[model samples]
Target: MIAIGFEGSANKIGVGIIKHTPDGKVEVLANVRHTYITPPGQGFLPRDTAVHHRAHVIPLTKQALEKASLKPSDVDCICFTKGPGMGAPLVSVAIAARTLSLLWGKPLVAVNHCIGHIEMGRMITGAKNPVVLYVSGGNTQVIAYAEHRYRIFGETIDIAVGNCLDRFARILNLPNDPSPGYNIEQGAKRGKKFFELPYAVKGMDVSFSGILSYIETLSTTHLKTGKCTAEDLCFSLQETVFAMLVEITERAMAHIGSSEVLIVGGVGCNERLQDMMGKMVAQRGGYLFATDERFCIDNGLMIAQAGILMFKTGHVTPLEDTWCTQRYRTDEVLVTWR
Candidate 1:
């Protein structure tokens, strides 16, 4: 099956094309993305991001098809992220997908954004039924597949880790061109000292709002006093938060009796987090799976991968039901194929 996907749930807009073969082989024909970057200390607003998506979705789609060396007639279905994202940005991409569906006369498959991340992570890492640690700008959860759903074992009680990192970057006036988190990671590499930050882990859940607030004040006071550099703060924050994530993930693994862990989402691209996770997994004599920025960050190909799986199972979204939402849950979709 050939699927073309559109994703614009956040500041980035992406278009990707992929094919699933009869022999169960998957091929990524094209994956193209464009990000809407804001100035330092500024977060991307939904309105501006929606405008960015509207401006680039068409060109990116064309680029994807051209890279795939295929026409619209060759695509089997039109796939799009249906929800759990910024409302206006989600709607902007959905409108494009809907129009393409109508124009190309292809069936529509609405995929849950979180499912896209999980499915793509599984496929990329070839980790069979591993504990999943999904960390993105908007979400943070430890999950496992059970029965017909991906059950959430643990999650952030307040803001997500990525949000915390991004907000911290804003406080430091770091550049957001590639991503504020990436810039923070670079600074973290130069950090030689680690400051103790609040580590909040409540059973299987975690919290970051307090940590972010605390660090923000520390950055303000310490930077002015020349007591701590930005790198020190970044390093400290990464270590503290990643340790929290690793702790919860390890707890989830112990509960589920799983030896393998797969990391997915935008924040998963951070090498520091991956390193910390690897150490914990190694100590447990288990394996850790992770992807680089190309797959880890929000992109359309992951949506295509999950959408094709749904389409293969005879799933289709009626035109009337092709709506976008901002609060879809990970366990909401029934995993019939699994």
Candidate 2:
């Protein structure tokens, strides 16, 4: 089946086309991502993001279709992110999917942004039952699949990991809209020592709000005292947060008897996190899989891959289920595959 996917959940705009044959694995015919950092003054431009989707995704969609040797009419389904993202951007992608589905007489599949991440991780890593660590701006959770369903073992009690980084960036007057993680990574690289930051761990569930608060206080107090550089603070912050994740992931792995570790979502692209998790997984003789930014940072290909799986299993959303919301539980959707 031929499918087209639209992703505008965040600052990035992406369009991907792919097809799967009964006897062969799914193939990515074309995958393209357009990013808008939105400069330093603005946090995020809602109108600009939508315009970006309209201007970039439409053209890229056409190109992807052509590259796949198919016309828009040949597409069997149009997949789009349904929720757990900025409403403005999701609206843009949803509208685009609706228009295309209507124009081409194809099914519109409302793919959950988080599910897309997990699906893409599974497809890329070939992990049947791996421990999943999902870290992104809008989400932070450790997951596993059992009894044909994805289950959340642990998650953020308050702010997400990426949001913590973004808020820290905002305080430092650094660019945040595209990715605060990148700037923090660079800042950490320039750092000389490991400073102390809050490590808030309440059992398996982690809380980043405390970490954000602690970091902000550190920056303010250090500035008043004239003692530390932003680079040191950034390094310390990443170390504290990533250490928390590594600890929790290791605990989850031990609890669930899972040796394979798969990291997904936007924050999964962080090289430091990957290295940390890689070390922990290796010590236990486990395999670690992290998607590259091409797939890790959110894109249409993951959604398309998810749609194909849902289609194969006859799991579909009715037009009534087409409605989008900023909040939806992963467990709310009935699981048909592990």
Candidate 3:
């Protein structure tokens, strides 16, 4: 079955086409994305991000179809991210998906954003039923598959880890052309000092609001007083926060008796975080599965992969029930396909 997916959860909008071959292999025919970049020291707002999606979704859809060498008539269904994202951006992509569903006479499959990341990570790395650590700008959760759902073993109590990094980037006036987190990672590479920062790990769960607030205060005084360089701050921030993530993830794995771990979501693309996770998982005599920006960051193909799996399992969103949401949880969806 052939499927096309639309994703516009945050600053980036993406469209992808994929096919589930008769032999059971999935083929990614096309995957493309356009980012809504903000100026340094700025963060993307929902309204602005929605505008970006509305402006680019059509062109991006055309590009995806062309790259796949397929027509709308050839696709079996239309898939889209339903939620756990910004309200406006989610609605924007949902409307596009609904429109295409009606125009092409295709069924609509609404996918959970986090599940998309999990399914794509599993497909790319061939990691079956591994403990998942989903880290993104909007979310942070340590999950494990059990029964009929992706169970969240741990998560953030406040802001997500990626949001913490992005906010730090804004304080440092880092460019957001590619991504604030990417720039922070690059800066951290050049850092020579490990400035101290708050570490808030609450058992299985973690928190970043305290760390961000403390770092913001430090940036105000430390940067001017030469107590620490931006690189040092970035380095310290990554080390501290990633350590918290690694700690929680490892704890989750231990609790669930899981040997294998999979890292998903946009922040999972960070080399430093991957390295930290790799070392931890290695010590436990297990494997760590990760992907590059192509699949790691928010993209349409992940949505397609997850949606098509659900579609094959006789799951389809009715036209009236195609509404988007901003509060969908990873454990909310029944994992019937699994």
Give the better candidate number (1 or 2) by TM-score.
Answer: 1
- Name the regions of candidate 3 deviating beyond 4 angstroms: none
lDDT of each: 0.95, 0.84, 0.94
Candidate 3 — number of clashing residue pairs? 0
Superposed by TM-score, candidate 3 places the C-alpha of residue 293 at a distance from the truth, in angstroms, of 0.3
**Colliding pairs, model 1:** none
Q: What is the per-residue lDDT of model 3 for residues 17-41, given as tens digits with 9 covering 90 to 100? A: 8899999988999999999998999
Error of 2 at 114 (Å): 0.8
What ranges in model 2 sit over 4 Å off? 45-48, 176-178, 224-226
Q: TM-score per candidate, in order?
A: 0.99, 0.94, 0.99
What's the lDDT for residue 273 in model 2?
A: 93
How should the candidates be ordered by lDDT, best one leading? 1, 3, 2
lDDT by residue (158-180, candidate 2, tens digit) is 98999888778878878764577
